[model samples]
Structures are given as structure tokens and as C-alpha cells.
Target: MPNPWDLPDELPTDLPVSRCELPDGRVLSAVQEAEAHTLWEEISSAAPYRKAAEGLRPGEAVIDVGAHIGLASLLFGGLAPESRVLAFEPAPKAYTCLEDNLARLLPGATAFRQALGAASGTSELTYRPYVASASTLYDDAEDDARNLEAHLDNIGADERTREVVRRTFNVSQRVTVEVTTLASVMAEHDVDRVGLLKIDVERGELDVLDGIDPACWPRIRRVLLEVHDIDGRLGRVVSRLSGLGFHATVSQWGVYVGGSVHLVLAERD
Candidate 1:
């Protein structure tokens, strides 16, 4: 399986390699290397994602609800070679690139070109994507005006601009998509034991969580998400899960502003 002709025969003593002269007529580098495919090596170590990568083991089922180009999935795959992952990315361009990258990086990983939410039926989805925040779910009304509290709840805003934007502008959409809830889809596949679940569905987080039942929260071991502020508080999201006994702690490592990326790690007692 190894081609000896491409390596040096002498292999230096001070170097970090051992050379083995083949019986027939070849030299092996004796340097072992593990193949990898990652966009940036350092980013994979930046978040709680780094800890997730370390805890990963072969065959653990993980779900990437908003897999953008499979960056996290690929990194998880590299850390746990034999694990099976399910990736869902809604944006057309991102999903396409996600599949393409997975094909070359994590060939065994499964990819879904659908958005995840609390419902199964088709609902309008605005593609904000990861790179842009303004490209969020558009209001049907071009001149739709939302109060600052409403905007902060849907998007994120402090007391600073609550009434300002409501008095000023509008939002529009160039596209819309159908979304499915995780429970419905996973139920169809009979996945009861979700080892890890990461939700970064831009602004559709509330919709996604709405689909999950309080009873099922115990089954979900981890939920790394970008939660939106419904009003001026994270209570609505927190209260819902808290009633179910999930110790929801909010943190400030961001991919989404106004609200923090909520890493609500829960375990069944």
C-alpha cells in the first residue's frame, strides 16, 4: 500500500523519521501521517466545539442542525473517524458546498438540504446565512414595522434602539424556504438517543426549540445554540427548559449578537 520510491533511503538520525530499506527495492519514510481536511486548523479549537471534539468517540451520533460548508462536521469527523454525523444546512449555496466538502472530507457523513425548525410543514424561511445578519427572515410586509422589543425578541437589540428602528425602516426578502423540526425528522428515522446537537439556524432558533418537547430535553445531552432574545430577557427560552429541569446557563461566545450562543448542556439525572 505504500510506495517506497517517493522517499529518501538514508533518513537522517536527527530527524523525526525512521527509514526502512525494503527487501525488493524501495525505501519507506517510516513517518506516519493521518489525513485531514479542514478549512482552518485553529478555528476548530476556538469554542466549546474544541471540548466537543475531545469527548468524541467512534459511532457516537451527532447532529449539525445548521451545518455551513461542513466545517464543524469535518472537524468532528477528523477527531472521531468512525463516528456517523447528520448535517442539515438550509442555504442553497452553503448546502451545496457542504455536500461537496463532505464528499471529500467526511464521505460517510450524511447531509440534508433542509432547514430545521419546530414544524414539519412548509414555512417561510429567510436565508440570513452565517456571513450576514441583515439577510434574516423577512417580514411579508415590505414596510413592516416592529417595536424595539419585538425586534430584539426576533433579532436582538438592547434598550438603546428599541423605538428608533420601529420609527425608521423596513425589511424585505428575496427568497423563502420550507423548514422541518428536529423531532419530526429524527422521529421519522427513529433516533431517540441524540449524543450531540448543535443548532445555529441563524434566526430560526425559537422555531426549532418550539418543536422539542419538555420531556425530550433530558434525552438531548447537549445543545450548542445561538439563542435570540424574545423581549429584553432570555427568560422565555430559559424558563421553558428550566421547568423541565435543564440547567440552562447563558454564555458570551458569539456567532449571533443581542443574544449569546447558549450552550445548554443537559444530562438525564
Candidate 2:
């Protein structure tokens, strides 16, 4: 396992990074203004992951898969100061922002510029610079656009706001990135127990779960992920967790009622 600290010296100079100041006075770096604001609203203000973060003890570990720009990571760090935060992000620009944010805000945290999947290898990731949070290895532009439109309508976003979001998904680029399994990461870092495993990899939630070797399942105390109920994925994920001795609960925010997105929280039985 490579040390995340030894990041490449030459970051893309042309990448446009925007800095957002939260109401609480903390600043965050992001590529897109709208995406950053939305993330802050959900991860910080709304605090959807709050329930799963409860009981996080000192010195425990929180693994954030698809950590777009470290907003959630910052939340976890603030919730449990001594706890270690291991954030995994595959997008190049996003990873750079994530690294910088963690360095300034959560010095003890570690940011990995790699994706966790069912295997260890390299793969092409569809990265939307304008909507960085939606980037994923499993790209579904049409479905994503539909879901976004529905969500905006459900929340009663104005026409201008809807147009802004529509433009964000219009352009994207594919970048090849390193991919590894969660079991491999745990073994390399010697993580004996995970306080929480928070995953929001667009539609790649199940693949992330599959990356965990059977032996590592019991080590994860809690699992929180955004599940796109494509096909029978939601049910399959619930069954898989149940089989691993976890009690899984599924719920959807009112804004996502008509969309395929749902949140699943699984705790060990």
C-alpha cells in the first residue's frame, strides 16, 4: 500500500478550484460552487449521516468511500476528534481538493486517491467536473439527469437553479484511476475494526460492498450508503447485509421519493 501522504507533486494547474465559506466559518475547496453548497447543506446542515455517526468512540476509524471533497469527512472528524478518517476518492481534481481540505481541517486524517471496488486494478471513472459529487465508475448520464430533475422538482427548486444543475451534468471526462478492494486496504493499514463505513459512490454501492472480503465483514460495525434502486439492488444489498449479521434499514428523503435513490443504514446485530 502506498502512503497517501506521498501525493504527486504536480497537480493539474488548470483545474479551477472554488473556495466556499460555510456559515460556521469553515472554508472548503471545491470545483463547482453549486455542488459544494449542496454537499455542505446535506452533509453538514442536514447531517443525514448523524445517526450512523453516533457512538463513534475515540481512536476509532471511519472509512469514507467516494469522499468527493471531504465535507462528510470533516463532519466525522468534528464528531470524533481522535478518530481516524480514511477518505477514498478516485477523481483527480476532487482528490486534490479532498487532500487539501483534510490537511488544513483534519490534519490527522488520511486521503486516498483511489477507488474501492470488487477488485484491485485500474478502471476508467466518469468524472463530472461541474458536478463532482456525481462522478462515478458506473456512469449513467441519462438516469442521473432524470433523477436530478425529479429531485429538484420535488424540492421545488426554481427554474434558474434547475438550469444550473442541468448544465453541470452536460459535460464529463473519463479518467483512468487505480482501484482496490476494501479488504486489501484494511490489511495494508492494519485496521482491526471500523466504526463506520460511509459509501456514496453514485450507482456503485454494491460493487463497493463486494470489495469487502468475507473475513472483513464482521470488522465493520456500521454501514451507511446511498443505494440506487436499479433492478433489485436495494433488496440484494439488504439481503447481503442481513446474511452478514447486520440489521439493515432503508429510507428515502422526501426530495428523493420519486427517484431511485435511497439511503441504507446497516448496523451489526
Candidate 3:
């Protein structure tokens, strides 16, 4: 059998291409090589987000927060062709790539070049070009460096391993991004209910969740979020979601090492 991760021979060279075709046979576009690799990992996962998206119904609404390059949005559109998807990505380069991918694969979905935060305003996003997904509103550069050093010391990590981590987390650029609340955006779009809500913002997961009006919480049927627990917000986020009357589960599956990140999936009881 052919290697599933191999780049397709027939892939269009004129545009940035997805490393692999999605489950529904739609291709994604990647602005960088790192983004393409990440997309392939998600496509190959057996239990991504604990299958939270499995609950989405046709013609329902889906929100893809931190929709870097629009892979998830494309996947959702393919899975639920009738569903209206709103994809939010703030990074300019990634947003441009997202726009291209969505237009090419799922023309009906809306892609927004804005970040979701606790309120409507603007904020700085610390971007790491080496690892685009590591870009975040929380500037954890010092903390990350210190933590990595400590871990290396504990394990007596080789020079190669230490160097890899250092380069992977290096900052490349800082950009100001427009921010809005989930509740506000939904209202502006006249979207009253959502069948699936997926959040993968590096460390702004809670801020995005907090931005959703409490009254509108009931209208969200399911949530899959990547929570950066290294900052110690996991407990608070889980508690907040539980208080909203949802059955919540947190796991390290599908996340990077260090036990600092986790996937939180919640659905109404």
C-alpha cells in the first residue's frame, strides 16, 4: 500500500497544497510546510477531539476558532456540506492561506481574519514562524525557555533534542490582530445556534470561551478546545463549562508532549 502521508503526484504546483487529501476527498492549502504536516496529522487521527464533531447535523452551524489555514473548516464543510461554517484566523499569512483553501474546497463557508477574545478590541499575537500553531496572545517565551531547560536537565537530554526545541519555539514576528467575542460575532452573523464549536487557539482558549455570553451557552451543542494547561487555566475552563451544564472530558491525547496541553471536549448532558 502507498504511504498515506506522501505528497500526491497530481497535486497542483501552482498553489500551496495540502500534504494529504482530507477524508471527504477535499484538499487543503498550506502557507508553510509546518502547516501542511499538522494538517496531515489531524486527517490521520482516529479520535481527534474525541469525535465531538460526529454530532454535527446537516444544515447546522459550526464555528472553527483559530482556524489556521482552514483545514478544520474544510473538513467540517466536507462532513456537513449543508452546515454553515464560520472560520476565524488572525495571523495574516495563515488567514490568506485559509481564504484560498476555503474558496478552493468549501466556497460556502465564511472565513474571518480576526481573533476571538474576551472582548472586542485589538491584541498582539506573538507569532513563531517556525511553528505557526504555537503563535498565541500569551507571551510565554521566557516561561517556555525556562521550562524546556529544566526538562532537558531532568532527562539529561542530548544536544540535538535541546537545539530542536529551542529553534521550534523561537519568535519570528509580533502582529496586532482584531479581536471579537464569540457571542458578538454570532449575533452579527445572525447565527443563533451551533452544532459544533471547535477551538484551537494556542493559549487563548479560555478567553474565547469567556467571550461567549452566558445566555447563549445553551445554544452551543458541542465544544472541542485545545487548552494550554501549562498556564494553569485548565481547571477554571473545565469548571466554567461544567457550570454551563455540559458533560466535560479532558485528555492529553492528540497534543504535544510536556503534559502542559490538553483537549477538552464538552457536550450537553
Q: How much lDDT does each candidate structure score?
A: 0.55, 0.86, 0.76
- On residues 70-91, what C-alpha lDDT tens digit does candidate 2 reach at each position? 9899988888787889999999
Off by over 4 Å in 3: 1-27, 43-50, 142-165
- Residue 235 alpha-carbon offset, candidate 2, angstroms: 0.8
Model 3: lDDT equals 0.76
What shift in Å separates residue 68 of candidate 2 from its native position after superposition? Answer: 0.5
Which candidate order results from sorting by lDDT in descending order? Answer: 2, 3, 1
lDDT for position 250 in model 3: 80
Q: Write the per-residue lDDT of candidate 3 for residues 1-269, one digit (tens) a residue.
A: 65243534333323343344555565555666655665556644636542766757776789999988877776667667888899999988778878888888887888999999899999998866555666788777665565557656656778766766565556367899999999998899988789889998977887898899977888899898888776568898889889888888887643345646677888898
Candidate 1 residue 116 C-alpha distance from true site, Å: 1.2
Best by lDDT: 2
Candidate RMSDs in order? 16.1, 7.9, 7.2
TM-score of each: 0.62, 0.91, 0.82
- Regions of model 2 farther than 4 Å from truth: 1-15, 158-160
Better of 2 and 3 by lDDT: 2
Candidate 1 vs 2: which has more TM-score: 2
Clashing residue pairs, backbone N/CA/C < 3 A, model 3: none
> Measured by TM-score, how close is model 1 to the native structure?
0.62
